[model samples]
Target: MSDPVRLGDVLAGMATPGGGGIPAQPGAGGTTCNRCGARADWHRTIRDKWILIELGEWPVGAVPPGKRWRVAGEGTAVNLGRAQPSDTCRICHFDVCPSQPAPVGSPALLAQWQKNAWG
Candidate 1:
Protein backbone atom coordinates (compact mmCIF):
# COMPACT_ATOMS: atom_id res chain seq x y z
CA MET A 1 0.00 0.00 0.00
CA SER A 2 0.93 3.64 -0.28
CA ASP A 3 2.13 5.82 2.60
CA PRO A 4 -0.26 7.70 4.82
CA VAL A 5 -1.04 11.05 3.21
CA ARG A 6 -0.19 14.26 4.99
CA LEU A 7 -3.42 15.97 5.93
CA GLY A 8 -1.80 19.40 5.96
CA ASP A 9 -0.34 18.99 2.49
CA VAL A 10 -3.57 17.63 1.07
CA LEU A 11 -5.58 20.49 2.52
CA ALA A 12 -3.15 22.98 1.06
CA GLY A 13 -3.51 21.49 -2.42
CA MET A 14 -7.31 21.53 -2.52
CA ALA A 15 -7.54 24.97 -0.91
CA THR A 16 -8.60 27.61 -3.47
CA PRO A 17 -9.92 30.58 -1.46
CA GLY A 18 -12.67 31.46 -3.97
CA GLY A 19 -12.88 28.52 -6.36
CA GLY A 20 -14.48 26.07 -3.92
CA GLY A 21 -11.66 25.62 -1.41
CA ILE A 22 -12.37 28.90 0.32
CA PRO A 23 -13.94 32.25 -0.67
CA ALA A 24 -13.56 35.67 0.81
CA GLN A 25 -16.45 35.83 3.22
CA PRO A 26 -17.09 38.21 6.08
CA GLY A 27 -15.35 37.56 9.44
CA ALA A 28 -12.69 35.54 7.64
CA GLY A 29 -10.16 38.16 6.58
CA GLY A 30 -6.42 37.81 7.16
CA THR A 31 -6.80 34.05 7.12
CA THR A 32 -5.27 32.33 4.08
CA CYS A 33 -5.47 28.83 2.71
CA ASN A 34 -3.14 26.67 4.77
CA ARG A 35 -2.39 24.60 1.68
CA CYS A 36 -1.95 27.19 -1.08
CA GLY A 37 -1.60 30.20 1.20
CA ALA A 38 -4.24 31.96 -0.89
CA ARG A 39 -7.01 34.16 0.48
CA ALA A 40 -9.96 32.01 -0.54
CA ASP A 41 -12.88 30.13 0.95
CA TRP A 42 -12.26 26.43 1.65
CA HIS A 43 -14.05 23.32 2.85
CA ARG A 44 -13.03 20.77 5.56
CA THR A 45 -13.61 17.19 6.56
CA ILE A 46 -12.23 14.67 9.13
CA ARG A 47 -12.50 11.13 7.92
CA ASP A 48 -11.08 8.29 9.98
CA LYS A 49 -8.74 10.65 11.83
CA TRP A 50 -7.44 12.11 8.56
CA ILE A 51 -8.85 15.63 8.30
CA LEU A 52 -9.56 17.27 4.96
CA ILE A 53 -9.38 21.03 5.45
CA GLU A 54 -9.64 24.40 3.65
CA LEU A 55 -10.10 28.12 4.50
CA GLY A 56 -10.46 31.83 3.47
CA GLU A 57 -10.73 35.38 4.83
CA TRP A 58 -12.51 38.72 4.22
CA PRO A 59 -13.46 42.11 5.61
CA VAL A 60 -14.96 42.59 9.06
CA GLY A 61 -18.56 41.82 9.91
CA ALA A 62 -19.12 40.40 6.43
CA VAL A 63 -19.25 36.73 7.42
CA PRO A 64 -20.64 34.94 10.42
CA PRO A 65 -18.65 34.37 13.61
CA GLY A 66 -17.55 30.73 13.08
CA LYS A 67 -19.74 29.36 10.33
CA ARG A 68 -16.89 28.92 7.86
CA TRP A 69 -17.04 25.73 5.77
CA ARG A 70 -18.42 22.22 5.76
CA VAL A 71 -16.98 18.70 6.28
CA ALA A 72 -17.63 15.98 3.75
CA GLY A 73 -17.95 12.17 4.06
CA GLU A 74 -19.84 10.32 6.78
CA GLY A 75 -19.02 9.47 10.42
CA THR A 76 -20.07 11.84 13.20
CA ALA A 77 -20.29 15.34 11.87
CA VAL A 78 -18.99 17.72 14.49
CA ASN A 79 -19.40 21.45 14.09
CA LEU A 80 -16.71 24.01 14.76
CA GLY A 81 -16.72 24.62 18.49
CA ARG A 82 -16.39 27.90 20.39
CA ALA A 83 -13.74 30.44 19.47
CA GLN A 84 -10.62 30.17 21.62
CA PRO A 85 -7.83 32.65 20.98
CA SER A 86 -4.50 31.78 22.44
CA ASP A 87 -1.09 33.41 22.17
CA THR A 88 0.31 30.83 19.77
CA CYS A 89 -1.24 29.30 16.65
CA ARG A 90 -2.74 25.83 16.51
CA ILE A 91 0.70 24.32 15.97
CA CYS A 92 1.25 25.34 19.55
CA HIS A 93 -2.18 24.46 20.86
CA PHE A 94 -1.23 20.93 21.91
CA ASP A 95 2.44 21.74 22.38
CA VAL A 96 2.35 25.16 24.02
CA CYS A 97 -1.18 25.75 25.25
CA PRO A 98 -0.57 29.49 25.45
CA SER A 99 0.94 30.65 28.72
CA GLN A 100 -0.77 34.05 28.54
CA PRO A 101 -4.32 34.84 27.51
CA ALA A 102 -5.15 36.26 24.10
CA PRO A 103 -5.22 40.03 23.71
CA VAL A 104 -8.12 42.00 22.24
CA GLY A 105 -9.33 41.32 18.69
CA SER A 106 -7.61 37.96 18.99
CA PRO A 107 -10.30 35.46 19.81
CA ALA A 108 -11.79 35.94 16.36
CA LEU A 109 -8.46 35.89 14.61
CA LEU A 110 -7.29 32.90 16.60
CA ALA A 111 -10.40 31.04 15.67
CA GLN A 112 -9.76 31.89 12.05
CA TRP A 113 -6.20 30.67 12.23
CA GLN A 114 -7.24 27.48 13.92
CA LYS A 115 -9.82 26.99 11.17
CA ASN A 116 -6.89 26.76 8.80
CA ALA A 117 -4.48 24.86 11.06
CA TRP A 118 -2.98 21.54 9.91
CA GLY A 119 -0.23 20.87 12.42
Candidate 2:
Protein backbone atom coordinates (compact mmCIF):
# COMPACT_ATOMS: atom_id res chain seq x y z
CA MET A 1 0.00 0.00 0.00
CA SER A 2 1.06 3.57 -0.55
CA ASP A 3 2.43 5.31 2.51
CA PRO A 4 0.39 8.04 4.11
CA VAL A 5 1.09 11.58 2.96
CA ARG A 6 2.97 13.93 5.26
CA LEU A 7 1.26 17.03 6.57
CA GLY A 8 3.95 19.28 5.17
CA ASP A 9 3.51 17.67 1.80
CA VAL A 10 -0.23 18.09 1.95
CA LEU A 11 0.08 21.73 2.99
CA ALA A 12 2.70 22.40 0.36
CA GLY A 13 0.55 20.72 -2.24
CA MET A 14 -2.40 22.87 -1.34
CA ALA A 15 -0.28 26.00 -1.29
CA THR A 16 0.95 25.39 -4.83
CA PRO A 17 -1.21 23.06 -6.81
CA GLY A 18 0.49 21.36 -9.77
CA GLY A 19 3.61 23.40 -9.08
CA GLY A 20 2.44 25.92 -11.64
CA GLY A 21 2.91 29.27 -9.96
CA ILE A 22 4.42 30.92 -6.96
CA PRO A 23 3.09 29.36 -3.82
CA ALA A 24 1.14 31.52 -1.42
CA GLN A 25 3.14 30.34 1.51
CA PRO A 26 2.17 32.04 4.69
CA GLY A 27 4.50 34.87 5.66
CA ALA A 28 7.45 33.94 7.83
CA GLY A 29 6.35 36.22 10.62
CA GLY A 30 5.28 35.13 14.04
CA THR A 31 2.90 37.91 14.97
CA THR A 32 1.50 38.60 18.40
CA CYS A 33 -1.10 40.96 19.79
CA ASN A 34 0.49 44.03 21.24
CA ARG A 35 -2.25 44.50 23.81
CA CYS A 36 -2.63 40.93 25.08
CA GLY A 37 0.44 39.08 23.80
CA ALA A 38 -1.63 36.48 22.02
CA ARG A 39 -0.17 34.74 18.98
CA ALA A 40 -1.58 35.83 15.60
CA ASP A 41 -2.36 33.56 12.64
CA TRP A 42 -4.45 35.71 10.38
CA HIS A 43 -2.91 38.13 7.94
CA ARG A 44 -4.05 40.51 5.21
CA THR A 45 -1.40 41.32 2.68
CA ILE A 46 -0.92 43.05 -0.68
CA ARG A 47 -0.43 39.76 -2.52
CA ASP A 48 -3.82 38.51 -1.39
CA LYS A 49 -5.49 41.70 -2.58
CA TRP A 50 -3.85 41.50 -5.97
CA ILE A 51 -4.99 37.91 -6.45
CA LEU A 52 -8.57 39.05 -5.92
CA ILE A 53 -8.10 41.75 -8.52
CA GLU A 54 -6.36 39.46 -11.01
CA LEU A 55 -9.16 36.94 -10.74
CA GLY A 56 -11.73 39.73 -11.17
CA GLU A 57 -13.12 38.90 -7.79
CA TRP A 58 -12.74 42.51 -6.69
CA PRO A 59 -13.79 45.31 -8.98
CA VAL A 60 -11.29 48.02 -9.58
CA GLY A 61 -11.93 51.76 -9.04
CA ALA A 62 -15.51 51.22 -7.92
CA VAL A 63 -17.62 50.21 -4.95
CA PRO A 64 -18.47 46.55 -5.12
CA PRO A 65 -22.14 45.93 -5.75
CA GLY A 66 -22.64 43.99 -2.54
CA LYS A 67 -21.58 44.02 1.10
CA ARG A 68 -18.88 41.44 0.53
CA TRP A 69 -15.77 43.42 1.48
CA ARG A 70 -17.41 45.69 4.00
CA VAL A 71 -15.67 45.80 7.36
CA ALA A 72 -16.48 48.09 10.25
CA GLY A 73 -13.66 50.54 9.57
CA GLU A 74 -13.31 49.94 5.84
CA GLY A 75 -15.97 51.12 3.44
CA THR A 76 -17.58 49.06 0.68
CA ALA A 77 -15.00 49.96 -1.89
CA VAL A 78 -12.82 47.36 -3.63
CA ASN A 79 -9.45 49.01 -3.58
CA LEU A 80 -6.81 46.36 -4.17
CA GLY A 81 -3.99 48.86 -4.41
CA ARG A 82 -4.44 50.00 -0.83
CA ALA A 83 -3.87 46.60 0.68
CA GLN A 84 -1.48 46.51 3.65
CA PRO A 85 -0.03 43.96 5.98
CA SER A 86 -2.32 43.43 8.95
CA ASP A 87 -2.25 40.66 11.51
CA THR A 88 -4.93 39.31 13.80
CA CYS A 89 -4.53 37.31 16.94
CA ARG A 90 -5.79 33.75 16.78
CA ILE A 91 -6.91 33.67 20.38
CA CYS A 92 -8.43 37.12 20.84
CA HIS A 93 -9.16 38.07 17.23
CA PHE A 94 -7.63 41.44 17.91
CA ASP A 95 -6.56 43.52 14.92
CA VAL A 96 -4.10 45.88 16.53
CA CYS A 97 -0.90 43.89 16.86
CA PRO A 98 2.79 44.16 16.05
CA SER A 99 4.61 41.26 14.40
CA GLN A 100 8.17 40.10 14.11
CA PRO A 101 9.49 38.09 11.21
CA ALA A 102 10.13 34.46 12.06
CA PRO A 103 10.61 31.29 10.14
CA VAL A 104 7.37 29.99 8.68
CA GLY A 105 7.70 26.47 10.01
CA SER A 106 9.80 25.35 12.92
CA PRO A 107 11.55 22.01 12.68
CA ALA A 108 9.50 20.53 15.48
CA LEU A 109 6.22 21.84 14.15
CA LEU A 110 6.99 20.55 10.69
CA ALA A 111 7.98 17.18 12.07
CA GLN A 112 4.81 16.93 14.10
CA TRP A 113 2.70 17.91 11.15
CA GLN A 114 4.41 15.32 9.02
CA LYS A 115 3.84 12.61 11.61
CA ASN A 116 0.19 13.53 11.99
CA ALA A 117 -0.40 13.54 8.28
CA TRP A 118 1.39 10.25 7.75
CA GLY A 119 -0.36 8.50 10.59
Candidate 3:
Protein backbone atom coordinates (compact mmCIF):
# COMPACT_ATOMS: atom_id res chain seq x y z
CA MET A 1 0.00 0.00 0.00
CA SER A 2 1.08 3.62 -0.53
CA ASP A 3 2.09 5.87 2.34
CA PRO A 4 -0.42 8.01 4.17
CA VAL A 5 -0.97 11.70 3.43
CA ARG A 6 0.76 13.99 5.85
CA LEU A 7 -2.05 16.51 6.10
CA GLY A 8 -0.08 18.72 8.43
CA ASP A 9 2.66 19.10 5.86
CA VAL A 10 0.19 19.62 3.08
CA LEU A 11 -1.75 22.26 4.94
CA ALA A 12 1.04 23.99 6.84
CA GLY A 13 1.02 27.19 4.79
CA MET A 14 -2.60 27.98 5.55
CA ALA A 15 -2.15 27.33 9.25
CA THR A 16 -4.25 29.92 11.09
CA PRO A 17 -1.58 32.09 12.62
CA GLY A 18 0.32 32.25 9.36
CA GLY A 19 2.97 29.94 10.90
CA GLY A 20 4.51 31.22 14.10
CA GLY A 21 5.88 29.71 17.32
CA ILE A 22 8.27 26.77 17.64
CA PRO A 23 5.50 24.53 16.39
CA ALA A 24 2.89 27.19 15.54
CA GLN A 25 0.79 25.94 18.48
CA PRO A 26 1.15 25.26 22.17
CA GLY A 27 0.87 21.94 24.04
CA ALA A 28 4.08 20.66 22.58
CA GLY A 29 4.13 16.87 22.58
CA GLY A 30 6.50 13.94 22.28
CA THR A 31 3.97 11.77 20.55
CA THR A 32 4.55 10.72 16.96
CA CYS A 33 2.25 9.42 14.30
CA ASN A 34 2.75 5.65 14.30
CA ARG A 35 1.62 5.41 10.72
CA CYS A 36 3.85 8.16 9.31
CA GLY A 37 6.35 8.82 12.10
CA ALA A 38 5.38 12.50 12.18
CA ARG A 39 5.16 14.50 15.40
CA ALA A 40 1.58 15.15 16.57
CA ASP A 41 0.02 16.59 19.70
CA TRP A 42 -2.92 15.33 21.73
CA HIS A 43 -6.00 16.50 23.58
CA ARG A 44 -8.10 14.63 26.13
CA THR A 45 -11.58 14.85 24.70
CA ILE A 46 -14.73 15.41 26.72
CA ARG A 47 -16.24 12.19 25.35
CA ASP A 48 -13.27 10.04 24.46
CA LYS A 49 -9.58 9.13 24.80
CA TRP A 50 -6.57 11.27 23.95
CA ILE A 51 -6.69 12.26 20.30
CA LEU A 52 -3.83 13.26 18.03
CA ILE A 53 -4.09 16.84 16.74
CA GLU A 54 -1.91 18.67 14.29
CA LEU A 55 0.74 20.94 15.75
CA GLY A 56 -0.42 23.99 13.84
CA GLU A 57 -2.77 26.79 14.67
CA TRP A 58 -5.92 26.38 12.68
CA PRO A 59 -8.26 29.37 12.43
CA VAL A 60 -11.36 29.53 14.57
CA GLY A 61 -13.59 29.53 11.54
CA ALA A 62 -11.67 26.87 9.66
CA VAL A 63 -14.18 24.23 10.58
CA PRO A 64 -17.49 24.02 12.33
CA PRO A 65 -17.48 26.03 15.54
CA GLY A 66 -18.67 23.05 17.56
CA LYS A 67 -15.69 20.96 16.48
CA ARG A 68 -12.99 23.41 17.49
CA TRP A 69 -10.24 22.81 20.06
CA ARG A 70 -8.46 25.47 22.03
CA VAL A 71 -5.21 25.17 23.92
CA ALA A 72 -5.91 25.60 27.54
CA GLY A 73 -3.28 26.62 30.06
CA GLU A 74 -0.32 24.37 30.94
CA GLY A 75 -0.01 22.48 27.73
CA THR A 76 -3.49 21.14 27.48
CA ALA A 77 -5.66 20.96 24.36
CA VAL A 78 -9.25 21.33 25.43
CA ASN A 79 -12.18 20.35 23.29
CA LEU A 80 -14.50 23.32 23.10
CA GLY A 81 -17.93 21.85 22.50
CA ARG A 82 -18.48 25.22 20.80
CA ALA A 83 -15.98 27.91 19.93
CA GLN A 84 -15.71 31.32 21.47
CA PRO A 85 -15.18 34.32 19.21
CA SER A 86 -11.40 34.35 19.66
CA ASP A 87 -10.56 30.66 19.39
CA THR A 88 -8.42 28.51 17.18
CA CYS A 89 -8.15 24.76 16.74
CA ARG A 90 -5.67 22.03 16.07
CA ILE A 91 -6.83 19.81 13.27
CA CYS A 92 -6.83 16.10 13.94
CA HIS A 93 -3.98 14.60 11.94
CA PHE A 94 -6.29 11.80 10.97
CA ASP A 95 -8.40 14.23 8.96
CA VAL A 96 -6.16 13.65 5.98
CA CYS A 97 -3.80 10.88 6.98
CA PRO A 98 -3.83 8.94 3.73
CA SER A 99 -3.51 5.53 5.26
CA GLN A 100 -5.15 6.13 8.60
CA PRO A 101 -7.80 3.56 9.29
CA ALA A 102 -9.98 6.25 10.77
CA PRO A 103 -13.01 4.76 12.48
CA VAL A 104 -16.44 5.40 11.03
CA GLY A 105 -17.61 8.90 11.95
CA SER A 106 -14.51 9.10 14.08
CA PRO A 107 -12.42 12.11 13.16
CA ALA A 108 -14.94 14.89 13.50
CA LEU A 109 -13.50 17.58 11.25
CA LEU A 110 -12.23 15.48 8.37
CA ALA A 111 -15.41 15.64 6.40
CA GLN A 112 -15.71 19.37 6.80
CA TRP A 113 -12.10 19.88 5.85
CA GLN A 114 -12.56 17.78 2.76
CA LYS A 115 -15.75 19.52 1.79
CA ASN A 116 -14.65 23.07 2.50
CA ALA A 117 -10.89 23.52 2.60
CA TRP A 118 -9.25 20.67 0.84
CA GLY A 119 -9.68 18.28 -2.04
lDDT of each: 0.34, 0.30, 0.55
Q: Which digits, one per residue and each the tens of the lDDT, describe model 2 over residues 57-118?
A: 22222221221232213211232333422321011122111222221233432332233234
Model 2 alpha-carbon miss at residue 45, Å: 10
Which is better, 1 or 3, measured by TM-score? 3
lDDT of 3: 0.55
Query: For every candidate structure, what is the RMSD over all alpha carbons to the true structure, in angstroms?
Result: 15.6, 17.5, 15.1
Q: Which clashing pairs does model 2 show?
A: none
- For model 3 the local lDDT of residue 76 reads 54
* Residue 84 accuracy (lDDT) in model 3: 64
Residue 61 lDDT, candidate 1, scale 0-100: 38
Model 3 clashing residue pairs (backbone): 5-98
Error of 3 at 88 (Å): 2.4
> Model 1: per-residue lDDT, tens digit, 1-119?
69888998678755533434344332342344444353432223332122223232233332233432233243222233333332211121211122224323445545545443423
Q: Per-residue lDDT tens digits of candidate 3, residues 1-119?
A: 59886888756733443243323332446577666655668654443245677667766665554556666665455766565657567666666454554324434455533432332
- How would you order the candidates by TM-score, starting with the best? 3, 2, 1
Task: Write the candidate numbers in order of decreasing lDDT.
Answer: 3, 1, 2
Candidate 1 has an lDDT of 0.34
